[model samples]
Target: MISIQRSQHSPIGLQLGPSSATLVQLAGSRQNRVVHAIAQEQFELDEKQSIEERDANIAAQIRQILSDHHFKGRHVISCLGSQELFIQNVRLPQLPVDEIAKVVAWEAEERLPYPLAEAELRHLPAGQVRQESNTKQEVILLACHTGILKRHLDLLEQAGLTAVAIDVEPSATLRCFHNSSNDVQTNATNCYLNFGDAATTVIFADQQNVLFLKYIMQGSNHLDHAVAENLDLPLKEAIRLRKIVTNSPTLDASDELHRSVIDSIRSILETISTEVENCLRYYKVTFRGKKLDQLIVTGNESSPWLIEFLSDRLSTECKMGNPFESLKCWPTSTSILERPGRWTTAMGLAMKEKSNS
Candidate 1:
């Protein structure tokens, strides 16, 4: 929970995700060039209902959260993951920005499996490319079913929150990273692994360009379940232990508990590494970019040694991301600053809303 005072007075931005909502109350002072951001309470939801059912439940949950905090400012921005949005990067004749909508529509109709009428689309120019035949250019068109976008918007409105902008999660994640790190501004290529409860999302970006986005079935909870089964412990206990133990710190000599947990996670990481490597190879040949500089692990329960283990196995630098950057961390209350990496998506959403406002 970092507090910031910026140079300009901007309306507060609220970010809502599937599982949680993170709010940042902001104010700015011009003379000081400071951005004042106060992190509000985080509200977690079940978020496991069927898509249709999830919306109503989430709406209620959000309303209650706002009531609890007595929050009224409604300018909000939400994010949809790559899974929810269909994105395609295509090369086209260098055209004016006004012509891009029609061109992108034509390309989407030709490229996407879904019908153009069924999809709600938007496009952004990536950059110009030099081809042997001509100087071609590319644009990344982001599309999603109108129904899907509507559902998210409806949910927020039902929650009594104003939804101002809908952004892609990959873009939000990358923006959050760039805002936090000066190193990434130098055009370094890196992979961001977002481990959720049931799934892991990997977004690879070169500087500002998003190269690959995917969702993996495996995640931290999968490792917890494996450990629970192997140790014959309750699910709750297994979860508690999972956050504490790593390859270096095995449980005990008599019990193979430590080995079991490490082995389970190692296997999962290996499978993910293979998939990542294949994606990297494709980008390397297609785009002719630098090799992957490192991998950043982020999630609620990211263990320190798990980062070490994966770094060793993948032969890449594995560092935990800091979700609490560009803000002032409260000294008296340490809970918000603790485990900040896991809040990357939520924090990114909050940051995006602030920027957009």
Candidate 2:
């Protein structure tokens, strides 16, 4: 959602995480787009650093990335990292568009873990739903704690960037495919799963418009944790084993170590799959509009093993998604985007049209 004056130009799309940043800029008309600039850098998060210090360091990193690339313009759009915001679809009596916000505030106070006064609340009217005999409005309610939201804007200002819009992960993730999904049948429902370092986002959409989304608390990092606990190894050591097994195409159940690693990873992935199943079930039961047509999965850790596991668990046509498929780019940009999953969120943010709503 937008919070400030909309930019007149195509601003940079910046995606920030706990330990890294990915920024993408695109130019040209909708029919002939090109990747203007793209880059990603990772940094170690030191627990000893205070929040202010941490943000400053991140801001410095953003500045460096900007200077080292061909990114133009200072206006940008951004998103809260994984688990940074709370999202839920709440039901209310049909109300005027201008009256939704006040009612949404009451709903937020009742549902949020934090107080109402401390939140930056926003709501979108997502059509009407049947509640027994009565029809109720379904509003997509979003709230990011004020402290976290302020910190996000602060970092943008520190890096000499103007924030035109600050979006959430699920919305940003869905927007990634907006430009390229026109040819698909709009009547059919589709799903988008975005895996990040700390969380995975599931978005259901039709013709690039989001129907609903779910933010799973688990991410790729959970794989490491599961392996460490299962194998009784140090966190770092477990990561070593996980890196090998997760991406390995050879999942020979006959091999001892491979079986052990796969089992360990499966324990956590199963839990994630269960969550996704529940999400899909909820969507079908609540919306009851259309059957799932496809599932597009993307992430930095979206390895063959992980994709295969998810596809087998989920009953749909699951495949990797490339957001830059329609964009022209040089080898330098292509090299960094070799694994397109990680760039989905950033590209989604950049793809957003300037809005006054």
Best by lDDT: 2
lDDT of 1 by residue, 94-135 (tens): 888788899889999988768899998887665555567577
What is the overall TM-score of model 1 with all chains considered together? 0.74
Which residue pairs does candidate 2 place in steric collision? none
For residues 88-197, write the lDDT of model 2, one tens digit per residue.
88889988888899899988989999999999988766666677888888788888899988888998999999998998776776665654644444566778888887
Q: Which stretches of candidate 2 lie over 4 Å from their true place?
A: 1-9, 179-184, 228-261, 328-337
lDDT for 322 in candidate 2 is 72
Error of 2 at 137 (Å): 2.1
Global CA lDDT computed for model 2: 0.77
